[model samples]
Target: MHEKQKARDVMTPDPVVLPEDTPVVRAAKLMRDQAIGDVLVTRGDRLRGVVTDRDIVVRAVAETRDISVTPIGALCSTHVVTVDPDQDADDVVRLMREKAIRRVPVVEKGHPIGIVSLGDLAVEWDPTSALSDICAAPPNE
Candidate 1:
């Protein structure tokens, strides 16, 4: 039997990433520039965490923290839910569902090689599901 499609097969290779010590403002800028909601935080090629736009808004701005001096690592979700590149895609979907998260980093030996979002999965692997339709829908903007 053929091996099931793994995270690597469906992941978005070369996902947006930044150093863990990146200033919050810079990190948020990168996310805006990339049109992405989240950016993977790294420490010299090693996966560190994920900083979402929401994190900046709630963890920093909402809290009236100094964005210009605060580093993303302090505000990012350090307990990031990650998937191995070789893991089955089904597992990734299940994890996302349980966590209610829309995206996960695909890692290999502690290094992030890609990301697999619900939208990516829906578009490429689950075209008939309602999620696919929702994910494939164009943004209001």
Candidate 2:
């Protein structure tokens, strides 16, 4: 069903990212400022890892660690799974489901190009028409 849809159609292009050396607090601040859940960690143009708000809460704060001394690289999920910009959305969705991940980085020519989230797919698969129906109806109904 998603054969005709490209990653570009759903991916957030030119996403803001952080360097591996960025302090955890700074990364968190950037995520908050951008209103994004995840931040790609890069070394030059190469994708190194990814850090999410959950990572900070679960791996840092919950662990009682100091954010100032912690590098984002320390909490980042390295060797992240990625998708190609030209790949079909259905294939990407299947891959995400199998990996149990809500986000996937879009890469091209060995460089990070964009990112896609579960929300992106939800909207791509069905825009406000379907989403409104799901939201407007009572959960038990």
Candidate 3:
């Protein structure tokens, strides 16, 4: 039997990242340009938090923070669960399921190198499923 794939095998590498002090607006723009839902927030090379599109809507916009000047660190989710590159993808699925989260950063030596989402797991575990098909679809303009 083939060995199970590791997190590195299915992760999307070189994920968009920004410093904690970066303005929330910049992170929003990066998400729009990259067609990604979240950006990893860092303090130096260490992963500090994560900011998702919804975070902007709920935390910044709804709260009326000045997006242009508000640092992403102020609104980003600081408590994040991460996986190491060598971890089994199957374990990642379990972690996601247990945490009820859709995404997890893949870290190495305290720095993020990639991100893995529920969609990534769908593609790897069941390519023919509807979720996998949706994950594989190109982003709508």
Q: Over 4 Å off in model 2, which ranges?
A: 1-3, 129-141
Tens digits of lDDT, candidate 2, 5-90: 88878898987777888899998888777677899998877899889999999999999889998988889999699999999887
lDDT of 3 by residue, 16-97 (tens): 9899999999999988888899999999989999999999999999999999999999999999999999999889989999
TM-score of each model, paired residue for residue: 0.87, 0.85, 0.95
lDDT of each: 0.90, 0.84, 0.94
* Cα lDDT tens digits for candidate 1, 1-141: 334889999899999888988899999887777678899999899999998999999999999999999999999898889999999998998999999998999999999999999889888876888999987776545
Which candidate number maximizes TM-score?
3
The stretch of ten residues in a row with the least summed lDDT in candidate 3 is 1-10
Q: Flag the better candidate by lDDT, 2 or 3.
A: 3
Q: Give me the overall lDDT of model 2.
A: 0.84
Q: Give the poorly placed runs of model 3, Cα more than 4 Å off.
A: 1-3
Query: Relative to the unseen true structure, what is the Cα RMSD of model 2?
Result: 4.7
Model 2 TM-score, 2 decimals: 0.85
Count of clashing pairs, candidate 2:
0
